[model samples]
Target: MNKPIKAVSFAAAAVLAVTICTFLIIRQTHEDVLSKEAVIKKVEASYEGKVTKSTQSKDKKTYEMTLENPKGTYFLKADATSADILSMNRVKAMNPSVMTEKEAEHLALKRVPGTVKKRTHKNRVATYIIQKEDGKTYEVKVDMQTKTVLSADQISNKDQQKTPITKKEAKTIAERETGGTADDADLEESEGTLIFEVDVDLPDDKEATVKINAYTGKVANIVYED
Candidate 1:
């Protein structure tokens, strides 16, 4: 009977030792991982914006941070242990008092009698691209808050050679490259080079702007909403 009691006690001691070792390993791992403050710092350094909110996943393996600046808002995800950026998104802000896209289009038409090709809103500014009846394309920017035209410039001449790529083709290329559909596409000229400016709607409620070269049908530059 004494031998059996001793055997039972030894088994219990082994089980307790294993449990304690497991707990210690987990605690050490947690200690080695980056802390919440450290992760926030990493995110701040990468995005240069004010952190508005921070949240951790239920599993405690990931963190989501919201950052804001004068340009727009950013949503970022980071790994809890490594503090590595998992994803980042940007969204443009819209003012309630701003004029609607249609209203801006009407105002642009009043200035130049042409068909509005595209209208985009960014940073409280509405840009309207119009193709005139004389076959010239013009870009007009309107201040949404003041309801005023900021600038209007002719981008294309009627006698200029036709572009190799169409606006629709440029939009498709922009969407494929960014993995987002374009909300607007405008043909504009920069330094004598014609390009298609496409606004893309990304996943996670974010926005992006892509510029495609009309001659090469390649992406010139892509920028997030911010």
Candidate 2:
């Protein structure tokens, strides 16, 4: 009886240790995710030019901003303890196109190919919220002028002359190196240094994370969304 009790106690202690370590690792990973999201939101605001609408995460460490004028949207991450530049100057320019709300929705749908959750339009440019099969949402931008999609997928900053990295290459790199799936990874971009980012799917249906790396295909970090 003594021996059985000791074995059970040891097992419980081992389980508790694993649980504590997992909790700490997850907390640290979550912070990394928030930090990267902040950088992305800052860069996006700089390019799109405004924070017309904003949403704050429950923890108050993340923000999602919708831009005015040309109408782009971005998600921002901020630290409760650390202050970061969450603002950018607006660019004065003509709206991409003068579009009716309905027209804008149609255009946005064409690009993202999903049910419209919400939409906003100014002049001819319109932005729409589309949900992926995973239930994750992505903002889509449509150009009424060219009937073109201006969402994150299309706005990659790679050289106009250089062929963009295909989805396969991205997957192969992630698999061989990071041991992460590449299905959702798209060729985002790298400046000075080659960089790419892939959104990682977590266990939850609607939650996901992002992974970024250098051009040599070295992964920098993995970022999670709550």
Candidate 3:
């Protein structure tokens, strides 16, 4: 072929290859979009509250929404294309201190390697259920905020340890010491330590407050309110 004809032929071949690749890429992307749409529909159905507004950012490639009726806001990566209940709430709440799944898992292992009974997430915060060597079960709440441990408490096995005088044990001892009824009101954590806090209603028309260390199974503080 002549030089000009040869050049034309090469250009045509290049265009054909480019067109083919572009078609395949567009087709695959369309399939992915369909799959994501299905998942998003499922999320919307499962949500009890309403989504008020949805917006997409061109620069950041993020999809943000205002969830109303319940008063919430959410943000998601445009590429994620799917909404989860917890993610939606977390984004809406904009709680910068919330913990990620990985962060929570790492903290749990550090606290008690083999004693992690279960771990779950709600609204971006990680919750841990752990058991001590003494066969006591405690709920540990980690605040995603500040990446700190929030609270810890012993809800079961209050009678595991045998005290010399169980009935006469000091209120502080009962709250701090392992194997005693520490009210088990609720647990919170801070920094890296777990805190067990409880409020007890006594029969004598009085109330007691209790706190404990979840890691060492020791009581931290106790208070009586009449």
Candidate 4:
């Protein structure tokens, strides 16, 4: 009797061990993430540009990719297993066509969740300023042609006031910073950061663009054209 019982116990232990190993193997297979090539192809099919850079997370659960097209440079995060888009945002944009007020308003509400109060357009981007009943103000920038949102920012009460720096002062600061001859500067505002973009002349027919803060007269950026 003891011999038979010992044999049955041994058989039960073997069966349990086999079941655990199979379960682990199945789980690992199910959790396997997609390859980098597969994720890139998935994004290219939906977006216009090819993936220029891709990085997988440490856990291999998601991929962050950078892509460039005529429209803009976009950053996208996608699920590694499902190849589903987790998030996408354009980091930079090229010139887009002018969008109408009606269209801009429609697009603005989708991101801002407020009633459109006023609209403005500059640099080929349309901005719809919205006001919520709670007295919160939001600014939404839309790419007029693509109808995609470039950014959505909330405006603090302090930003509603006029900027302190004058146009002439902005040009002077930009010229001083770049040490080049400045032309008429254009005042531009985004995400509550006001800037005066000045095109300046250098020697030998070269040109440089200088961007200065409109409020603080601080130099923001300068780019040289070859």
Candidate 5:
């Protein structure tokens, strides 16, 4: 073949290879990207809230989603083609509610049966942080306006010492010290120490609050009141 004709043939082959490679890359990307329906489902499944708004970026490579849960409004960004949550931020903190906190606490206690740590009302939602007698913690979300328990999730497992005394042991110690009937037991961690505060009903309308070290079965103090 002549020199000019051979050069033109080589150039044409190079162009064809580039085109084929580009086409394959595009096809692979399309196959890998999540579908519209799938992206929506992924967002809903991963987040515990209603997705109020979802839209793809101008480049169509990212999805911006707004979620509203019992906590507050959240802004999230997910990969357009993959089920990966890129970023999540609380954009707006819900305004605190004034009333219905006690009502919410009642509903949460009925569900989890624990001592109330704190109650927070946000955007008509009430969240109760409760700790059980065994040192396990839980978070209960309640709809404050409607006075309903939305969710009860255990946040932590029981933190029991390797050779710690049980509730019965604590109760026995308290009753022995006070010479009264043990009525209630509350286990809590204080300054890296597990303390069991037992309520004992004394005779003649008297009461005793006993604080005992759970690990050693030793009575820390006894507070007596009428």
Candidate 6:
């Protein structure tokens, strides 16, 4: 009976030793990992701003840094393990004399008039979510400084119309109309009209926007930019 008891005690001691070694190894690996300050330097190199805030995730595997500069504020996420940049977004600083929400809404309505569902102002950008008569949603972003429409995108649910023209066909039409290569294309709705907004790259570093009707497969509008 004493021999059996001694054998059980030896096994327990071995298990404890293994657990201690594992913990030590993990601790050493963590200590050897890159520090947060090192990661912040990498972000600053790209953004060139004052560090406003820094935080680590609950898992301690990633870091988020907020930096501010004269141009704008930026949020950057980096992987702690490898200090790799995961994501970045810039919010242009608001100018006190910039257009108001109402003004921005009016401007956006001029471009694509519809029922305003939501309006948001942040970091000098005003966004209007508009619902057209056909129940499609459009998201329009306006730049405060220029008081011009920055981008307009449709965020409505997938169209249930199975007979609509395919995206490839839309791009071909856009390319033919603009005499340029279609660099980007997206299907969107404007004023109850389903259209494809395609960005084309033309000669001499020029750009063109081509809007093709999704249902009719016709060129709705084409505008060139220098």
Q: Evaluated with TM-score, which candidate comes out highest?
A: 5
lDDT of each: 0.81, 0.54, 0.56, 0.81, 0.81, 0.79
Give candidate 4 regions above 4 Å deviation: 1-31, 96-226
Evaluate residue 49 in candidate 5 and report its C-alpha lDDT on the 0 to 100 scale.
76
Q: Find the number of clashing residue pairs for candidate 4.
A: 0
The Cα RMSD of model 4 versus the native structure comes to 20.0
User: Please, what is the TM-score per model?
Assistant: 0.39, 0.27, 0.31, 0.33, 0.44, 0.37
| CA shift of 120, model 3, Å | 38
Residue-level lDDT of model 5, residues 1-226, one tens digit each, is 9999999999999999999999999888778777666887888887767888888787667888888877789999889888689999999977655446777788889999977765667798888767678766677998876567889987642634322478889999999998999998888777545689999999999999999976668899999998
Local accuracy of candidate 3 as per-residue lDDT tens digits, 1-226: 8999999999999999999999998776555442444444554566544555555455323455554434355443333343443344445443364566778767765665447756777774678877666555667777675676676766544432322223223344554433334453454553434455666556556667766554454566767776
Model 3 segments more than 4 A misplaced: 35-40, 56-62, 69-71, 77-226
> After superposition on all CA atoms, what RMSD does each candidate show versus the true structure?
23.1, 33.7, 17.7, 20.0, 14.4, 21.7
TM-score, ranked from best to worst: 5, 1, 6, 4, 3, 2
Worst 10 residues of 6 by lDDT: 155-164
In candidate 2, where is summed lDDT lowest over 10 consecutive residues?
A: 154-163
Model 2: per-residue Cα lDDT over 71-124, one tens digit each: 434344334334354554434445455455677677676666655554667666
Please write out the lDDT profile of model 1 over residues 98-166, one tens digit for every residue: 787778778888887787666678987888777777656778998877788888888745533356678
- lDDT score, candidate 5, position 51: 86
Off by over 4 Å in 1: 91-226
The lDDT of model 6 is: 0.79
- Model 6 regions lying over 4 Å from their true place: 1-3, 91-226
Give per-residue CA lDDT, model 6, range 76-137, as digits (tens): 78888787889978866744568878888899988778877667788989987776777666
- Cα-based lDDT at residue 78, candidate 5: 88
